[model samples]
Target: MAFIANMLMAVYQTNISDLFEVVDYLLMLKAPSFKSVYKWRLEQEHKLRERIHAESNKTENSHVMTDTEVWDFIQYFQRITEECLSEMPARANFLYELDDSRKIKFRLSNL
Candidate 1:
């Protein structure tokens, strides 16, 4: 579970490229000891990625995220962070406030 916390810290405080390292760390958590938890996290991450990709491809003239999409993204991250924190509260306390920063950067870069 410490691994989950590490991954959340990386996600909350790092750039997208840097977050890739978090993904790698997550993969490490996929071992049998943590398989169920890791699988749940993977599903949540996959959904979040799908939503982000869809929003990113929208055209300015006719692009908008539904409330559901917004909700999904917010919930996705919340769940992820919560799960990590639950497993390792200490690491959650160390997260940098980079979540919004990374989100904005992703938006701009995609544009």
Candidate 2:
């Protein structure tokens, strides 16, 4: 979960909007039970986007994504990571046979 939060923070700092969506999608794919929170978070994201669009209109220079977009994305990512990690087991033995290299590769590829 800490790793997830750190990666999400990095994504926000990089201004990679797609990664925010991807993380949400990945969490949903990993656990169908988290669908409700995922959808709620998506709605929150849209609201944040709308707010950013509105705020940018007041500026002389037009902007694509406002600070609110990054802030909200970071908040949602943190919340979702916390919720998801709380539900998942500390460690699953299903992949015990695979070496760490293969496991990390599979995890990244899956995301």
Candidate 3:
């Protein structure tokens, strides 16, 4: 999805306060959407190369990002997110229906 690509770009390129806000959402994608994400990853890798060549540094880290950081982040996030999605509902708060006319019920989990 384009939204996923944009969200990753924002988190990768900007100093967002929420360190890993929407990472869980990335778990929803299947095989077809992989190319968009792969493209973004390629762009980040290219940026890392350019930064290295130009002697550019970001903030206090003395580095921008390694080629594997994003991939590793995704791998870990995917595992944890999958587990949470499967198990968190059992630990969720009990939610009550507000009105008798409404049939649907759900708990709002943390993103």
Candidate 4:
């Protein structure tokens, strides 16, 4: 049972990580307007916060993580997303001002 629980937690973490990766890739395309990107980021943040709150209240089979641990994870991810979102306007401006001769490289090092 412990092994299964650990496996489930691992899978959950991977899925969340992958979702963020997809979002990062989409943002690199800059196909969506800045407003749309900001909206999506806000939505994601809200969803994550809700998940953390829900998890914190769980009592059964709570070996996956303690409430404090969940809060820490939430804070860490929120800070990362906030940093990325804060830089979006500058990145968008740079992309807009760039000519065909120049290309900008987007890095997800912060993640």
TM per candidate comes to 0.24, 0.26, 0.28, 0.27
28, model 1: CA deviation in Å? 25
| Model 1 residue pairs with clashes | none
User: Which lDDT values do the candidates have, in the order given?
Assistant: 0.45, 0.47, 0.48, 0.49
- Write model 3 residue lDDT over 75-99, tens digit each, in one string: 5355334554454455434332222
lDDT, model 2, position 65: 41
As for lDDT, the candidate ahead, 1 or 4, is 4
Per-residue alpha-carbon lDDT of candidate 1 for residues 1-111, written as tens digits (9 for 90 to 100): 679868876876677556555652221111122333344555665676667668776444443445455555455456554555355423232332223122212111111
| Clashing residue pairs, backbone N/CA/C < 3 A, model 2 | none
Residue pairs in candidate 3 whose N, alpha carbon or C atoms collide under 3 angstroms: none
Better of 1 and 4 by TM-score: 4
**lDDT computed for candidate 4:** 0.49
Highest TM-score scorer: 3
If the candidates were sorted by their TM-score against the true structure, best first, what order would they fall in? Answer: 3, 4, 2, 1
Candidate 3 is scored at a TM of 0.28
Clashes of each: 0, 0, 0, 0
